[model samples]
Target chain A: MAKQDRAIRTRRMILLAAAKVFEERGYQAATISEILAEAGVTKGALYFHFKSKDDLALGVLDEQDSHFVVPDRACKMQEIVDAVMLHAYRLQTNPMVRASVRLAMDQKAADLDRSGPFLRWSNVIQQLLEGAQARGELLSHITPARTADVFVGSFAGIQSMSQTISDYEDLMGRVSDLLRHLLPSVAQPSVIASLHMSGSRGAVVHEEVERLQEHDPSALAVG
Target chain B: MAKQDRAIRTRRMILLAAAKVFEERGYQAATISEILAEAGVTKGALYFHFKSKDDLALGVLDEQDSHFVVPDRACKMQEIVDAVMLHAYRLQTNPMVRASVRLAMDQKAADLDRSGPFLRWSNVIQQLLEGAQARGELLSHITPARTADVFVGSFAGIQSMSQTISDYEDLMGRVSDLLRHLLPSVAQPSVIASLHMSGSRGAVVHEEVERLQEHDPSALAVG
Candidate 1:
């Protein structure tokens, strides 16, 4: 069990290093040697976990699976809001998520499966909207799948614009504004009136996710 | 007169070649030599118009200034819709805009003015929305600037998503869906009911722009 834990630790370390180097230097220009130096691990140790440069990139792509539990809210629509807010928060402060987004969006790194994150995020939104629909939270015209696509695309664009304009420092505000413009068309008036669309909600969720993680270590274990 | 015309033609050729190269190789990896080869111009000719590869990139950035005159409609909100639909149309078919968007969004190309286009686009929408407000075409609570920002960000995100998922084959549909979701919050019920949001609007705008340009060369001369 101890040996298994050590292996997981090494893999995590390697992935972090790879994420940094790949983001800074790009996948084509980034080298395994640089990753090794950044990781402070031997080539033998790195190779034990990742077989190639592509393997290291795949690991980083999967590294986007950072889990934090948000307790059930009164409105599942609010949970949808919280999910995006949490992601924006992490995409701002979390190096791993930032790197993954960069890698996935990089046209130069076309070989990487960039669609995985898009699909996963859309799925998350779809699930929340489904719950909203079940509980009479959304409008009659709003379809979960289609709304999910819009949410995914809009968030991707907002974060991207924020990244370009302000390095995501203003992403929370932009995202808040986005939801304000969009949610009226997606949710019922009663639900829309109750939802929180503040950019600062990210910071709140960030703190909450952190608190939850400390309280229950297993809470962050998302697939 | 002959010499001046030659210079103009050479400059246009170099800009097109540079846009193609930048789109394919990105700013960092793109080479002057590749651009020269693509343009099929001499080194001296290329250098005569563009001082450096960076200058060539700026030229491509400016090349996105394609102008088309969409005729005035009953609803100003429809004009905003037409503008985005037209842009989506142009973005699908126009190589220069694609390259410019790619260049502006490339984080590695941090040396370039990334926010220039986003600000320009948002300003366009803001101006339109302000007009809509004056005419009472918009919702009472909507702010032009914030709504414009959301419009720019959402379109960008949708376009990017379409590029990733379908290489923009479904861009028009996605954009139509986007405006449907957004216009309700931005426009009055009467305006929203009258707006024509469709994928084919792009091709129509493209033809209109072309016809206008054909009749008046100055029509395309946007700042």
Candidate 2:
């Protein structure tokens, strides 16, 4: 068991090092030698875990997937939306998440399967939207899949924007504001009301608003 | 005058060839020798126009910028929105635009002060958003600069998504549908109305709706 744990740790260390190298130098330019040097792993250990550089990249992507855990609670649509916003906020603050974002954007070939991080998040939201729809918590006409695509695509865009603009500190608030505008058009009144009612204590929702009001008043207008 | 005209034409030819080489081989892999070979120009001619490979890449960016002329006439906000959507539609069909999209997203660094295509588009959108705000077309609270970032970033995301999911024929429609959901929230009502009205004749938008109707009825129901 101890030997197994050490192997696992070594594998993770390699993945982290490879992710960093790929993020810095890009997929085509990044070398395995740099990854081994960074991870302090022998070539044999690296080869034991991954067959080739492509396989190593896929392993890095898989490791990335493990880190992006969505909260597994039953909540209203707004709560889910807030969760998504907070995820973006956390991603903005975390260096690993930032590096992953850069990798995701640059590693276009790695996204052959539509089931990447962005799409997985979209699926999670789609499932929630389906639940919302079955409960009549969404507009009868709002298609869960299409709504999911728009939401995920918009969030990806927002995250990219937050990265670009240095002065825009309240990314979560802007995300929340954008969601508020969008939700009214697709969500049922009950869902909207539930979200607003829960807004005070919901750390994801309220914290975003408070942070926005403090840092970026121009982003969130009360009216 | 003839000599100056010849020099300008030769420069344009070199830049066009460089764009192709950069698109095919990417920035680091593409070399001046390959660019000169493709352009059928001598090394002396290539050096006469561009100081280095980086300078040549920048020249390609500058040449692409010349094609992105903002519409001269100002109409309703919807007209502007439709114009933008139509431009996106053209990008869906045009190979040059598609290549440019790949270059902009996968290659360019995110810094605005740098001479990359993404930053150039970001700046142009910033100016347009500011102009819209000054005309009372956009909400007063939203910062033009941040909005520009969101707009440009979202466009990139959507373009990337469209490129991934559908063939070139269907890309514009998917992009248009995504934009329809998005434009309503940020753009004025008149703009929204104009976009929907124009949708009747928009080959790409109508075809997308038809395609959705045929493949997935749920998508049309939402739209």
Candidate 3:
């Protein structure tokens, strides 16, 4: 068990270093040597975890799905907002998420599947909207699938704009602005009135999610 | 005068070929040789038109701003819808526009300015919204700048999703869905009712613009 834990720790360290390198230099330009140097690990140790730079990139992409944990809400519309806001918060603060965004959007690194992140994010939003629809949280005209596509697409665009403009400093505000414009079309009037959409909302959601995770360890078990 | 016209035609041919190559291979991997071959021009001819691949990419990017011509409406909100739908139509059918979209979103092409498209799109939307607000066509709480950011971001995200899922075959429907969801929040109720946010709306706008362009050549003189 001690040996297993050490191996896991070392793997995590390597991934962290790789994310930094990729984020700084991009996927094609980022080198394993730089990643190893950054991690202060031997070449063999780096090779043990990530066989190639592509493997390291895939490892980073895989990390995109983890880390977000928004608690279930009575109004799933609000829960949907919470999920998006929490994601925006994480994108602003997390290097892994930022690196993954950069890697996913890097059109030159055509080896890995570019569609993975979009599909993953689309599914996440679809499931939440599905829940909201079942609870009558959605407006009459809203379809979960179409709305999911739009929300995921819009969020990706917003992240890109933020990346180019302020490097995610205004991501929270941009997200708040997004929810304000979009939620009205997706949610029932009562639900819309009750939900909070603000630039500062993501940070608030992040704190609430963190508190929930602390109270219930099961919070960390989300896929 | 004939020589000048031939020079313009040669320059246009090179840009179109470069856009196609860049679209297929992206900025980093796209080659001048491929563009030259695609254009069916000699190296000297290609060099005369564009000094480098970067210049060719910029030419492609600059052309992204053109080819959409929407006449102003009594309610500027309708004009905003026209602008978006016309863009969607162009994206579906025009190779230059599609290639420009790919290059603009290619995060790896960091040497060229990525913000040019976003800023241009934002400015277009902002000016439209400002006109709408001046005429009282907008909702009371809407701001042009914030809403412009969302529109540009959402449009980009939708384009990316369309590229991944169906190579933009459903881009028309997706843009329609986006406009429908967004218009209610931005426009007054009467103006919202007047808006045509449909999947086929882009094609319709394209036809109308073409007819207008035919009647008055100055219609194509937009900067």
Candidate 4:
């Protein structure tokens, strides 16, 4: 059991190092030697965990959506907002999430399949919108799939712009503005009125999610 | 005059070749030698035109907005829509534009400042939205700057998604969907009813702009 725990720690250390390098140098430019030096792990251990740089990038991408799950809300619109806000908070605070976003948005990484993050995000948002529709939270003209794609794409662009302009210092504010503009178009006025869409909402959601994970440690599993 | 025309043609050839290489390999991985070979230009000619690879990439980036000006409309809302649709059309039909978009969105090109395109786009859109507001075509709560950022970011995201998913074959349809959702929130219902937001708006706008440029060739200057 102790050996297994050490292995897990080593794997995480490697992933975090890889994320740092990938964030700094991008996928194509990042080297395993730099990641190994950063992690201070045996090359054998790194190779044991990830076969190639592509595999390492995939691991980082998977980390973006693995652990952070928002608790359910009565209103699906608010639930979706929480999910988005939580991501904004994480992007501001977490290196892993930032690296994952950089990788996913790196058009230069020709060998890396960058579509997973976008597709997954769109699908998750689509499911929430569909749930909202079942409860009549959406407007009559709202199409869950189309709206999901728009939200995913818009969020990607907003975050990228925020990253470039302010290095995500204003990401929460930009995201709040995004919700303000887009939610009204999709949700009922009453639902939109009740939802919290502040720039500070991310920090609040982050705390709520962290507390929930503490009580149920299994909820924090890193996939 | 003949010598000047030859110089201009040679410069254009280098820029086009640089765009092709940049589009394929991205800014970081692309080399000037490859661009020279692709352009079939002598090393002296390439250096005379562009100081470095960065200069070449910047040249391509500038091309995206240089020749493709959308003609003004009485309704600024339609004009903004035309601007966006025309860009979508160009992204489908133009390689230099694609390369420029790739560079603008390439987060890995740490040496390149990608904010120029986004900021320029937002500013342009904001001006149009402000015009719409002045004409009483906008909703009461719409802030032109804020809404313009949303439109720019959303369009960026939508285009990236379309590129990844379908190589932009369905980009026009996706962009039309984007305007459809966001326009209702910003534009007055009457203005929304009058505007043409179809996927084919791009082709029509492109033809209109092309005809205008042909009549006034100076309007198509490669800035």
- Candidate of highest DockQ: 1
Candidate-wise lDDT, in order: 0.81, 0.61, 0.80, 0.85
Model 4 chain A poorest ten-residue lDDT run: A214-223
DockQ-derived CAPRI band for the predicted complex in model 2? acceptable
i-RMS of candidate 2: 3.4
* Cα lDDT of model 1 by residue, A1-223, tens digit: 6999999999999999999998878777789999999999999999999999999997887667545356567789998888888888889888999898777677656566667777777887888889889999988988898899999998888988899899887888898889888888998898888877676887887787778777865544242
Model 3: per-residue Cα lDDT at residue B93 = 89
User: What DockQ does candidate 4 score?
Assistant: 0.64
State the weakest 10-residue window (summed lDDT) of model 3 chain A: A214-223
Residue pairs with colliding backbones in model 3 are none
Worst 10 residues of 3 chain B by lDDT: B214-223
Per-model TM against the reference: 0.93, 0.75, 0.86, 0.93
True contacts kept of each: 0.61, 0.27, 0.62, 0.62
Specify the CAPRI tier of model 1: medium
Q: Give DockQ for candidates 1 onward, in order.
A: 0.68, 0.27, 0.52, 0.64
The digit string of per-residue lDDT tens for model 3 on B1-223 reads 6999989999999999998887677677678999999999899998987889888888898787855468756778888888888888888888888788878887667677777888888888898899889999988999899999999988888887777766788888888878877877888888888777778878887887788778865654242
lDDT of 1 at B135: 94
Model 1: pairs clashing at backbone N, Cα or C within 3 Å: none
Task: Provide the lDDT at A76 for model 3.
Answer: 76
